[model samples]
Target: MDEINSSKQVSVRDFTTNAVQVLDPGQDVMQWTFGGLSRDSGHFRDADLAKILRNVTAAPASAFKACRTPEVLRIIEILSIEQGQKWGVCTLNEFCKFICLKPYATFWDWNEDEEIAAAAKALYHDIDNLELHVGLQAEQAKTLWPGTGLCLGFTISRAILSDAVALTRGDHFLTVDYTHMQLLSILS
Candidate 1:
């Protein structure tokens, strides 16, 4: 906050130079990310803030080796999962069935990683017990086909597409020009 208030506007060239200097993979790119830079004594540096911005926007997508999320965050995540379950959120298998896809028989079906599957099994006990949102985040991004650009979780992608079609079909505003008959064919 201090940095934002005190900083002067910088030219595009200066911004680009700073970004290039930090984004060099040979350097410790991970140190510039949100979790790494100092927040000690309840303060942070302007250069650290700038580095974080570059890391978020310009860093390579494949650079992440691990989540590196703090242990405290895992406790918060557990609370979130409990709250979602309490609110009657469906399990991942249920959601898959609802979407006309086959329900996953095991955690292995959800993801190939043995460690992730083991963790899910320890927490949820079975595939049917896995929470929807947790599975959405944990599942590997499916390569739908050649040339399909976006790398998204399979269930998340399906849910978004389902919601989009439902919105188009149910909303009177979106159907103003296209006939409901034609909309069916197009959305279908």
Candidate 2:
């Protein structure tokens, strides 16, 4: 921290101690790192850190081009409606569409007894095809974090948002979730 303060080459944000505490609960040691301080310290007074945060927070809509195909949009609409109703939202038609849709579409026969059963089969087929095309992206990821290996199966689907955020270099990777934040800090 003293070296960073002395060099003064990179603009640093000053996060309040309170904010830092809130953002990093278990891994408070991260506050000592340059990136962590910039995010947790109430020091947005620094021009450079402010600019970095702004760039990070902006949505990457262009990346969603692949997610908006007609088939994906339809599925997203269905999922969004179901999710919206559960959340007590009045009009989730549009928002649900956005959340459920993806750039890639996988087709499957829907003759199964249950809609979920049919959807799972379709999703499995799509994943198998995707695995062939991408050559085990999760396997590649295991090389990066070898200790526990890459999360797979059901957990992989739940991690889509985090995976997307991880791809963004400009994002502030801060959070109270120690495990995720720790991984982000290392990856960043």
Candidate 3:
């Protein structure tokens, strides 16, 4: 884990230098999650992270009526059948009803209407061909060039370590039993 952090510390510096070059060319890059280095640094403030999560949750729900993905629906149906077999009652409806129990059930709580609408528009613009790539490249940039305070720096640094497996596409996700060199197989 320590070694991965050290490597990421180095990679972030390199990535940031490259990002500056790309942005300098007037490219259309989404810098919203760049930890505010590109714009209002207050957006990346600690209080904002929680608000961001809340907004994300509400935006999807308001824009899509429901967050029912096919995979999630299937999981709910299977769980319903299993629970019905044991309790002789359809727990599926109860589970579905419980969706409102979430904190973002009301969109007003997050003030996310505009953000969600904007995100939906952006997503649909490129929806014809979905990109399989993860957003780790941007995440890497955030960890490297975060414009937040020392507290955020330490938080993002630790996050970089925790998500090292995801960021590097390592063979194993984060396992204390493994050495850093073995995990670098993904990089190779």
Per-residue alpha-carbon lDDT of model 2 for 1-188, expressed as tens digits?
33533322322232234355656767755444465445435443467777767886784322211122244234344445456557655221222234553323322221122543345445555433332211111111222245753333222333466568666644544443445758879799
Please give the range of 10 consecutive residues that has the lowest summed lDDT in model 3.
131-140
Provide TM-scores for the models.
Answer: 0.53, 0.20, 0.18
Candidate closer to the true structure by lDDT (higher is better), 1 or 3: 1
Report the C-alpha lDDT of model 1 over 148-184, residue by residue, as the tens digit: 7666777778888999999988887667757877788
Which ranges of candidate 1 are over 4 A from the true structure? 1-76, 144-149, 178-188
Error of model 3, residue 163, in angstroms? 43
Off by over 4 Å in 2: 1-34, 38-42, 54-85, 91-188
What shift in Å separates residue 170 of candidate 3 from its native position after superposition?
56
Residue 152 shift from truth in candidate 3, angstroms: 42
Best by lDDT: 1
- Give the Cα RMSD of candidate 2: 21.6
Per-prediction count of colliding residue pairs?
Answer: 0, 13, 0
Summing lDDT over every window of 10 consecutive residues in candidate 1, give the lowest-scoring window: 63-72
**Per-model CA lDDT versus the true structure:** 0.71, 0.38, 0.37
Residues 50-70, model 3: lDDT tens digits: 676887677543111212234
Off by over 4 Å in 3: 1-49, 61-70, 90-188
Order by TM-score, highest first: 1, 2, 3
